[model samples]
Target: MTRRYVIVGNGPAGVAAAEAIRRHDTAGEIRIVGGEDTGFYSRPGLAYLLTGAIPEESLFSRPASDHDLAGIHRTVGTVREIDPQRHRIVLFDGQAMSYDRLLLAVGARAVRPAVPGIDLDGVVTLDNLDDARRILRLARRAKRACVVGGGITAIELAEGLAANGVETHYLMRGDRYWGSVLDPYESALVEGRLAEEGIRIHRGVELAGVIGRKGRVAAVETRDGSTLACDILAVAIGTQPRLELAHLAGLQTGRGIWADATFQTTDRDIFAAGDAAEVLDPETGKRGIDSLWSAALDHGRAAGEQMCGVGRPYRRPAPFNVTRIGGVTTTLIGAVGTGARDVDLVTLGRGDSNAWREHADAFAVVSDGEANHLRLVLGPDRLVGAVVMGDQALSRPLQHLIRERVDIRWARDRLSRGPIEVRKALQALIERTVPLGAA
Candidate 1:
């Protein structure tokens, strides 16, 4: 008898899992369930779609015929509940499906702030293709738009709105943008670029509420007691993993659904992936939920292979993400988030107030700035992480160094100076480490 597999969610993780299952377990019955009625669409492409850079049909990552050709059964409906004991899942529409193995790739949902008037008609979020379409339509006629958030999503939305000739206002409660990933200097660099693009950025101001006129947003009221007129309000605050189903099923969860490196939940037959799954680090015992597109694809492939009787711990390559904010390209790689407790940081120009030298050994800092800036997080033995803004030519080399954990101790003094010196130092290290042809 052929094994039956039911995968929930049709985002990157779900679709990748389906494709992987078809590749590895040819005889298995594969079924993918998604709440959306459409085929696989690229969530990231929604920004381009809003800017009119890409057509609606181009939003789809995979055509409907791809699913048909793969012999994968597609169903549309929300999975209301999972009966783990009976190995069955019930849809919100009251349909039941049984599976030998189940994978939850439910992804995440955009977080709407708890301010009043958030439910106003013109207040929207870009999560799905539908949201993109709505925003595109609104942008064409919008005179003024306000985007609230600090992450990549907010930047993308603000840029899109500005591209469509909408007067855009970016509001951030923090003094610096993306303080979670970038330091003050780096944030300033990005903020400068955004301002140059004619975006009005309001820093250190909280979003008090939205003011609606006839059920449509008329203006945004800031906690500072100032009102800014705007017709469209886009919130890209962040996203929270959709873990209600897993929680309801009694699955162990932390920030996300807890899963081992093998993508196995507490129950051996049930697995989780995408932003919903938290993959634990064996050495540090820390669970990391990488919300990047690459992480979802990697997790799905690994989970699918493991489910097909090939058990191998998923090895995450160094996390990497690239984005264009204010026409300046920024690339971040490895554990660049400021949240890590064990990580140390060092900066070139700033006076040494870093706590790492007294307690821990490894750290990172903004090394140098010219037409571009380079920040490096150094471990005891290798390059741990990096942030690059402008002159992205260094991105590839830095990525290899961080991901491959190349030794850079030989050029310690030179590396401490900043970008230009660090580049030279890295070149020296690369010559010794990588083969001539490879370099």
Candidate 2:
């Protein structure tokens, strides 16, 4: 009898796992169970959809026909329980499905504060398609909006609301935006750009409570005793891993579901990935949350490959992040260490182009003057981490450096000296990787 492979959750990791499993095991039964009502779509594209830049139909990462043609069964439902001993899952409807191998890709959900009036109308959290749609609906009639948090999601929400003509206010507990990924200088540059777009930013502020009128949010009270009047309150604080199922099933979890290099859970037959899985960063050697879409896809693919008897060890790469807010584009790779020991600081330009660089083995180049910055962290002549801003032309090369760890010190030194032959070397690298047609 052919073995059955069951995957829970329909996000990027879950979907990618199904495709990867089919790649190695041609005849095995593959079933994907997800709590989402709609089929798989790109989570990152949700922000774009709100801006009307992309149609809802365009959000689907894979066509429905693709799943059908692959002989994969996609079930839209919730998995309430996992029975690792029996290698089975119990759905909310009490239906039990046996599996020879199970993949737990149940992603994280938005964390709402425990403050009062959270249940009031007009307050929303964007975690999935449904949440996005609801927020868009509220945006249509919203005059004033408040976005709470300081991550990429908060920036996206604040910008999106402002674009729709809503009076937007960004509430952050930190002194700078994206404090985790960006240095103080880069954060200031981004903050300045948002301010130019007419978005008011309040730093070092916390959401104390929500004042409601007629069961709808009227204003947001901050811990500083200042209240901002708004028609909508969007909570983009952060996400908590959905580990109830994993914990209940007796799987080892800390910070996130603990998995080895092979992406396997404590139970040999079970595996976990995506936002739910906490994997170590190869560069920092620290347990980190990989909420990015690319990381999740790679995690699922690795898990699936391992499940299919492939003798492959999962390679955890440095984390990469990219975001555009108020027409400013920023890309970050690896951790921008908090203090001085792990990183060295570099600055380029003054005023608008001023950006702070942090690296020990890593080098960051910020051209805040030209709205451009590039950070490269080298490990034994290999690029480990990088951040690019303004000019995205160098993103591909930076990504290549991160992947191949190319020795471009000669080219980098040349650019530093007099900008003599940097373009030639960069073009050569591009030609080697990107196809001529695409180039």
Candidate 3:
């Protein structure tokens, strides 16, 4: 009998799992149920679509015909319930499907602010293609737009709206943008660059409520009682993991669906991944949620491989983030200045447009003019995490260093004097993994 593999959700994590399962078991019956109308598309790229940079057809990870070719059955609907004991899923359309193994990748949902006038028109949240389309339509008519949030999505949306000739205001509760990911200095640099582009930023503030005019959002009132008039309001506050199904099935869930090192849920035969799952942080020894695309894909792949009987243990390397704002590219890898004793600081540029660095204990900050690159080194010579802004060329090497734990003491000393020989350093690091004969 052919094994049955049923996956819920069609995001990056779920798609990667399907591929991983196919690699291990060529003849298994694989089925994917997705809530979105489209199959797998780049979640991060949805913002670009709002700006009309990419066509809607190009968003999918694979062509529509590929599903039939791969011998995988895909159902477009919502999964209302999951029965772990019986290994069945109840769909929103009242259909039930039994599975030998089940994977959950339901992802997360946007967090709507709890305030009056939130139900007014011209208020939107960017969570999917439909949401993006609605926002794009609203933005076309919006003269002044206000984005409320402090996360990366808020920053991206604000920048995109501003680029489209919309007067944009970014409101955040923190003193700086991306406070959870970047340090104060790095955050200031990014905030400053956005200001230069004529985007208004309100720091250390909270949205009191949306003020409506003619049944539509006309302005936003902050906690300080200051009102900013805007034609549209975008809420990019954050996301909460979609764990209702898992919770209903009596599976353990923390900030997200609780999974072991191998991506297995409380139920041994069940697994969860992507934005819906939370795993232990190897650095902090505490459970953490990584909502990045790379982490989600890796988690899905690992879970699928394990389900197919591969004995690969999930060894999460580090959390990393990369984004481009107003033509400035930034990458963040490993850990930042969180849970540190002392930090060694370095700055490559000056003012709100310079690269900033904060190194303490095992962490290092490397930035160059409006682009902030952060690298967190953990335990001896291991590179644990890094964040780079403005230059992606630096990310590849930085990622390699953090992943392989390359000892850059020699390179670090020479970097300040002049351009350090990256090729030589990489070659030296490769020697550790590759044999001399292969080299």
Top candidate (TM-score): 1
The segments of candidate 3 whose C-alpha lies over 4 angstroms from its true place after superposition are: 281-285, 338-360, 363-383, 408-439
Better of 2 and 3 by TM-score: 2
Candidate 1: lDDT over CA atoms? 0.79
TM-score of each: 0.91, 0.86, 0.85
lDDT of 3 by residue, 312-403 (tens): 67877645666675456766665554442211111110001111123335644343443534333343345555566654655676666666
RMSD of each: 5.1, 5.5, 5.9
lDDT of the structure predicted as candidate 3: 0.72
lDDT of residue 275 for candidate 3: 83
Model 2: which ten-residue window has the lowest total lDDT? Answer: 345-354
In candidate 3 the C-alpha lDDT for residue 367 amounts to: 35
- Which residue pairs clash within candidate 1? 344-363, 345-364, 346-364, 346-365, 367-418
Question: lDDT at 36 for candidate 2?
Answer: 77
